[model samples]
Target chain A: MKKLILSTAALALVAGFASADVVRMGTEGAYAPWNFVNDAGEIDGFERELGDELCKRANLTCEWVKNDWDSIIPNLVSGNYDTIIAGMSVTAERDEVIDFTQAYTPPDPSAFAALDAGLDVEGGVIAAQAATIQAAFIAEKGWTLIEFATPEETVAAVRNGEADAVLADKSFLDTVVGSDGLVLLERTEMIGGGVGMGVRESDQELRATFDAAIQSMKDDGTLNTLIAKWEVSSQW
Target chain B: MFSYCTDPEALEGLAWLSCYLTTGKHMGLYISVVTVLVLLAITAPVALAFGFAGATAARSKFLPLRWLGKGYTSIVRGVPDIAFFMFFVIALDQGFEWLRHQVKCPDWPDAIRQGNDFVVCTAAKLPLSASPQWLHETYAFFLAVLTFAIVFGAFAANVLFGAMRAVPRPQLETAEAYGMTRRQTFWRILVPQMWVYALPGLSNLWMVLIKATPLLFLLGVEDIVYWARELGGTKNARFTDYPHGDWRMWYFFALLVFYLSFTKVSEVVLERIMKRLTHGQATSGGEAQRRANA
Candidate 1:
């Protein structure tokens, strides 16, 4: 038992001093702008490319894996993935369990889209998934809110004109909202907390490297171009 | 420190209630219940009907037709049911368009099934592109119902065909001797007498059908499973009037109760049916009935 404990302590000490090398990244392959697998079976999108760039800048070898939106976090917690580059909105609730890097993409809460062209939804209030700061923003705006199984359904409701608009992340709005005739109509008055690069709580060194990666990407003007690529129809 | 609870700190009565009810996902959770019932309600009858036809065809005098029915029942039974559910719907939808493609969009030259993708003209799209969200949902449900019916029907057919043959050949022959035609004897003797034997198999089929309702979520029906996940997902306290932690376990527990209640109700109905079917027949159930109540 003494030897086992000593070996474990030695391993921990080694891990602490060892350079950050290989990192496993998690992503929900559903959302288009963030990360989605295309017809050619290649993961393509802003998040996908950005993660590669971040790894390169951080001097780390990276591996990407697709997971369902629901299982993404549990898998991360279970040590399946070291980082999540999925457009995961960092909330205080999430921070309690897992730490996040500095904001890579600013919050732009979702806007409404409608089936009817002249539906006059400019000032109508809305609701998004509960527990989200978006829900609080909804109450502040005094809008009726609805939750759906997927963003696809929420957008479907807007397309069906069930609600005046959907409240969601700006990046989500960019990916989900269509241009046929629907429009954002309005943006929330205050900016909600933005999405950030996620890492396991113990991976502070990795998080620091990710923060540096973000700064490098921003300086190179590559981040702006990547944002432009994903932001097909920006809400903000 | 806040545990996974739907209701935490309360501000007021109505305010708390409103927050509790409108946590946003409640509506979808509620709708999923209807979707499951609707899928089951339609699919069960269609499956039963298809099973009846398939069983009859398997017993038919025509060699090729009998082989087709036999092949359908056996081949489907061997494969994973979910695969049939996934592939059959897409195949069936494309099959519908292929028929329509041959007639409607014949001039447009493109192979309908290209490798893994099936593409038809925009005009040939099932439930036309301009249809509403509810219509898309309905169309998807229609496809699911068809898929469930086709798959479950095959199983039911195998059960029913055995039950049909289990009816005494002597009884059928006696009916024929009485100057009754084959159709008349089938209805008057074979169909009536086959019930006692078929009841056991059919009751088992009914239980399976009830359990299979969860598969609707896999088909994108947004049923109870979808709602449970959506509503159960944790929301950050940073954004809501009434914030809570992950309550997915409780949501799943509620779903378990719903399914159990559904199963209990079906069991009662099937029991009642079994009693009714056993009345005044040559079988042991009928014989016991005569001795007990006579």
Candidate 2:
């Protein structure tokens, strides 16, 4: 009986370790530069490349899962995936729900893009992605904020005249404003801390593995190279 | 579309417009229309089969079967369908994972529902964690179809149940007088006659099913509505070869025309079907046709 129980316990341990080998990386796959789905319908962006490198360095097999921005964190916490590398910035409110690794990219300034110049930033309708730091910042500023599910819809709201302007990460708006008929507002505000990988609070061991990988990248300047290559904000 | 279209920026007028319409993302939009059609084709028959089962159960001599059928039909009638659509997809997904977790990981100790989070064991993950992108999409599409069928199947059941009752009591009595068994009467006499009565309600249900295809976007299937919003929105020069202003209104207009034409064709086809089903029947439609022929 003792031998049978011992063998069964050992088998269970092996099975547990086997299941832990593959880490699922959740991403919005809609945010450009940070992450977005390519024309061929695969997750392709800066984060995609960075996440792959982090998985390699950590010696963990990683797979990507595209989730909507609104449910990304909840899905991460709910065990839909193992980690969130979806350009999510570290915030106190979010930290309360889920834990984060070291910041992968430095804090990027948020800018407002509008069709017309000089719209009232205080009272006019401003669009932002729902549950984002920019959306919370706009709400704190007492602006009439219209929240959208994705970043593209926020820009669409500005162009469709539903909102006067849209506030999002500057790198995101830069591509939008460079196009015709839309211009970035002079007013830009930096909100939230640097972006980080989110892991469930229960998964501290997985978080430590990624944090070490991120720290090594930061130490060796490889992180900064990726930041520059992706045309994101300043280096760490 | 034109020979000079090689120079996108240099080309002016219709040439530029023609080339712009043929962008890769625009091809996705075209494919989405087929997605909607495929969904309708699959769901309609599945829902009809479900409705047939539910209606048959409702008319069964057994008490428990009748209550089960009644419960299925009436429960869905009480709530808005969009609410049902949103609720069932998540509920069913979690439900499946939970069932798998119980069987696959008997030794795992954590509670599956931790506060608002649903934490199933890694081994129990639906579609498995290592499944390809296409499998993930196919899984979501499968969930969307199941949700659509269940909700619409209840509505179809209600219509079919009422149609069964409308199949003239005397026709069933005639079957009984001819020494037919109850099951034989149901199959031979009642089933054929119910369709004539059910045709109008089913056609209306078919129209509702078409309009509800847009709800697939809510399930994250990237249907035509999603593609339209993505491609028709302002495309900056940095992101695309063909930059354009906000042309969402035009794209939506195109969707509007497509649905209208689809419904028009469906209406004509359904009318012809109704005529065929009503032929030689005791309905007003059959009587009018007979009078016209005389």
Candidate 3:
């Protein structure tokens, strides 16, 4: 048993180092259609497929690292990963911390999910995941905002009547709405710039590499294909 | 960071892993291990003091003091520790904010709990929204430690109360015969002799405390278990440098070893302390030592 374990460790270590010119991509695996852990316990969804194609086009060996959404950019900046492809939308506040490549997906509409279709979303208590654009939007509108750590909890808050509605990315809420008596409200808030790959400010060369790949993907319509297949944001 | 680590793409194998393991997030994991140790060190003593106070108060001559002490232990101990943790941190944070809100925003028109949202004035926010991330994390750690101390302190009190009572009544009578005051009997006699009885229970509590460190994650402290799950999930070539299939089993296995080794060390240390406490006392442990010495 000991020998078998040692041999496995040795093989894994050797296999791990075989790839040179590697790019580490960071994502939050909990967000579906954007990036999520599939039934096989492997990361799947729109960003995952797009990231893989981008890495292949860039001729860089890449690996995925799942990080919490709350710390995704910080982890990227601190060298835990080489890039953030975690469905993160471009924003001025985030730009101050790290650079973003050309957007792969267009600005996704933020929608409200509530128990009642006629719920007063504008003035009612709102739920959003902390540190998200939706959360910021709610706070900006001066609505009563209750924040949870994860997206699921935001939905749970609305279901349990802790909040009147949960505001989230339409791509995320599309699969969630219509179940558990959740109805999508009519009001849609288009917030944030298009979703893009995030890189550390110092990684200019890496950013340029990904930007070229993303541009190529956009020109050839492969990015739009993946976006449509995953039913994420509208085509570029 | 090593010299070759400057270009992560050029690195392979052990070199790649060396850099990967030394990343800032990994360093956070390493530091959080220290956080657990620090929590245990601080909490054990604080909880013991609380437990001592509680046990002593339960034996108090004053009626209200005794009731207060017993009530504290019963109420805290009756609720599940997880439920207590979830309730206490929010309650304590809101309690502090509410107090500050009353003082800071006395003229403010809005009620704090508007519907389900607990909105304290910006000035009254705990650690403030604009405070640095480390300050927020530190405040959370402080709350976690306080909650752990309160919960474990109650259990410790129960053990200590029984231990105090178990000290022979004749021993107190004998102290009285020697003209020792009630205070002196408790301090010089009852307190001193109770430990030989208490050490076994306290040692068990120590093990439980070590096991309970993982609960820090639930309180949003990002403890060792949190790091394990974060780092060990499946990573394909699409997202990170070190791509692997679901390696959570391995990461959790490493945690298992860490906890076992830690508990083993605690057991050895507790055994030594037990020996020291039992010395010359009229107990089975002291009798065993006397026979071995003879």
- Better by DockQ, candidate 3 or 2: 2
C-alpha lDDT (0 to 100) for residue B180 of candidate 3: 99
Q: How much of the true A–B contact set does each candidate keep?
A: 0.00, 0.25, 0.00
Worst lDDT window (10 residues) for model 3 chain B?
B127-136
Model 3 interface CAPRI class: incorrect
Candidate No. with top DockQ: 2
| DockQ of every candidate structure | 0.02, 0.22, 0.03
Candidate 2 on B1-294: residue-level lDDT in tens? Answer: 446667688877888888777756567788888889988987888888879888888888899999999999889877797787666777877887788799899999888766555777778777566555455566677778778888889899999999999998999999999999998999999999999999999999999999989888667677988777766666555545676777888999999999999999999999999999988888898899899889
lDDT of 3 by residue, B1-294 (tens): 567777676788999889878866577679889999998988899789889999999889999999988998899999998888766766876786688779778888876654333656556555554433455566677778778988999989988999999898999999999999999999999999999899889989999999999989766677898777656654434445455544667878999999999999999998899889889888887899999999
Query: Which segments of candidate 2 are over 4 A away from where they belong?
Result: A1-20, A115-119, A178-181, B1-27
Query: Once superposed on the true structure, which residue ranges of model 3 sit more than 4 Å away at CA?
Result: A1-232, B7-10
Q: Give the per-residue lDDT digits (tens) of candidate 1, residues A1-236.
A: 23323543443334334333457777765455566554233566778888998888887777666555644565455444578877777887778867899877766545545554354443553536544556666676566677653555565556556776776666566544345455654534444566788786766787899999998877787787778776722322
- In candidate 3, position A20 carries an lDDT of 42
TM-score of 3: 0.62
Q: Candidate 1, which segments miss by more than 4 Å at Cα?
A: A1-236, B1-19, B22-24, B109-117, B238-241
Tens-digit lDDT string for candidate 3 (A169-233): 89888867766688999989989998889887766788999999999998999888888898888
